[model samples]
Target: MLRRRLGVARTLKDFQGQIYGLNNLGTLLLQTGNNQAAAQSLVEALEIARSVNNEEAEGLTLSNLGLVEFARGNYFDAIKQYKAAIVLRRRFRDPLGEANTRNNLGDAYLAANLPEDAAIAYGLALQLARTTSDTPNQFRAFRGLFNSYTEAGNYPPAFRALNQHIALAKEEKDLFQELIWLRLSAQLYTITGDLANARSFYEQAIALARVLEDTGEEALLQNDLAQILYQ
Candidate 1:
């Protein structure tokens, strides 16, 4: 269908339709792990967007291109593409797009082993996501911060971010995810020698696991709790 649209759009010389068709196709390909094909389609879309001054298409294409680069392990190139996309998204007054692009930039930074930079990008993404009431992206930003800070050994802020992430999981009523985050929080606290908090989080996770009927998680959490208690 997308290929047919691309064909029709090209025949009609409808630059906008061509851009949209190409971007959609590229995004679909990217999602399916066809990075090379995705990049080809996106590059063509980007060229057409630039030639026609289609700012929105250009921005969307750039973001898709960033995903391609990230998938290919070209972190620096991915960061560059995301930054360009973010600037265009911001200029077009698309806060949601900008926020999502920033989150992508955070992931690229993390991939490049730049935890501090990733933290900064995630912080900006969180603020933008909150402004737009994008709860999912807000959750994602916190998750990124949790990973960034934990990797950097910044335990206090990492724990704080993990707590917020878990709270958002509760808000979304995703009990299984909440249990996962709670167990991770317990581990983080344990790493920091905060046995009381570790035990508390572990207990909370155990209770939640029981509620969810996840016997395996419950058993694991109980064992972890026992180990910490022994220490």
Candidate 2:
């Protein structure tokens, strides 16, 4: 209704709103595996954001573009987009946006196999999230750190980071985070040679993933469980 009412005007405000709507649609497309369509939508939205000189919208659209690029295995491009978004969000004093951009930066670094750089990005993201008191971002940052440390062969820090992520997830009552924490905890346990705990957590994560209808995560849990069993 609002979109229809604003259709004739099509002012800068309308363009900005359209940018937001398109960005959101792009995110949904990305999550549903339509990377090409997501990229197109994000690019269109970014153009509109630029035309309107909407810094906040531009930053968010750039972040969405970064996600699409990252999913498409264009890590360097994704990092560049994320870095630009981070600069804009920082200039605007948008801590939540900054945290999200940093998290995306961490993802790009991780994808590029630069775990130490990923760790640094995640650490900055975590600190910013804490400053904003954003529980979800805090959980994501901690999860990033956990993955970075694990890939870097820093088991102790990985385990500690995983524990921090789990604690934050519990505080937020986030079922998805709980599921991820369980899965990662299982992997960490296996790596640390805690076979019994690994098996137990893997089963728990599998059950939770089933309940959540998260087939991708369930598949990962199954694979990890198989590997642990073989070990």
Candidate 3:
């Protein structure tokens, strides 16, 4: 249906419609893991956006392209595209777009083993997300910070980041994510020899899992809680 609309839009010389169609198709393709097709669609959309002087559309398309490259393990290329998108987003004064691109850039940096750079990008993303009241991006930025700090062996900061993520997850009412974060917090506390916190979080996670009827997760958390108690 999207392709048909794109074809009709193209024939009618409807640049805006064509761009929208292309972006939609690209996003769908990307979500479905069709990197090559997604990239092609996004590239065409980007060209149209540029020709039409649509900075917002251009930034969005570039971000999609970055995602395609990132999924293909081309971290450098993804970073390049993300930087381009960030530039356009900043120019347009779009805080949410800027935050999203920055988060993507952080992920690319992490994938490239540049933990410090990832942390910097994530910091900016987090600030931008907060400024825009973009909770989802804020969560992503926190997750990125956690991963970057962990990679850099910054244990305390990593734990702080994880706590922030868990807090946000709870705010969003994402029980599954909250459960996962609680489990991770328990493990982190255990690793750092904070047995009291570890036991508390583990028991909390187990109780939550039991309430959710997640038998597997409850059993796992119970086992971890028992191990910590024995230690």
Candidate 4:
């Protein structure tokens, strides 16, 4: 369907439709792990967007390019692309796009072991996501903050961030994500010697997993609970 759209766009000389089709193809390719093809498509899309002076499309394509770089472990290059996208997003007054790119930047920084920079980026993303009432992005920002703080050895802040992420997951009714967060909370509590909370969260996670019929996860949570009990 997307290839057909691209073909139709070409036949019609619809630069906008061509750009959109290429962008969608790039994103789909990336999601399917075809990074090389994704990069090619995104690069073409970016060129088209630039030619048309479409700042929004340019910013979005740049951000997708950053994702490709990030997936290849080129953290520095990812940061550069993300920053470029962020500049364009800000110029367009696209708060949500800027916030999303900031979160992506935070992920790159975290992967690069730059916890402080990751924290800063995630903090800004969180603030922007809140302002925009972007609940899903807010959850991502908190998850990033959790990883950043944990890597920085800031346990208190890390737990706070995890709690926030869990709250958002629950609010969104994302049971699978909530179960994951619960297990993470349990592990953190256990590491902190808060055995009571650990057991409670593990039990909650186990129960939730069972309700969802995720036997693998339920078994994992049960094993974790058993360890906590023995400890």
Candidate 1: segments with Cα more than 4 A from true spot: 193-231
Cα lDDT tens digits, model 2, 1-231, are: 534533533554668668877887789899999999999888988998898799888999899999999999999999999999998898889999999899999999999999999999999999999997988789888989999999999999998898888777788788999998898899888888899999999999999999999999899889989997986
lDDT digits (tens) for residues 169-204 of candidate 1: 888888777887988888888988889999999999
What lDDT is obtained when candidate 4 is compared to the true structure? 0.91
Whole-model alpha-carbon lDDT for candidate 1: 0.92
What total of clashing residue pairs does each candidate reach?
0, 0, 0, 0
**Residue 134 shift from truth in candidate 1, angstroms:** 0.4
Q: Which ten residues in a row have the lowest lDDT in candidate 3?
A: 176-185
In terms of TM-score, which candidate is stronger, 2 or 4? 4
Give the best candidate by TM-score: 4
Which regions in candidate 3 have their CA more than 4 angstroms from the true location? 166-177, 193-200, 213-231
lDDT of each: 0.92, 0.89, 0.91, 0.91
lDDT, candidate 3, equals: 0.91
Tens-digit lDDT string for candidate 4 (89-148): 999989999999999999999999999999999999999999999987898888888888
Cα lDDT tens digits for candidate 3, 1-231: 999999999999999999889999998998998999998999999999999999888988999899999999999999999999999899999998899999999999999999999999999999999997898899889889988987887898998898788888878898877887888889878877999999999988988898889999898888889998997
Query: What TM-score does structure 2 among the candidates reach?
Result: 0.81
Comparison by TM-score, 1 against 2, better one: 1
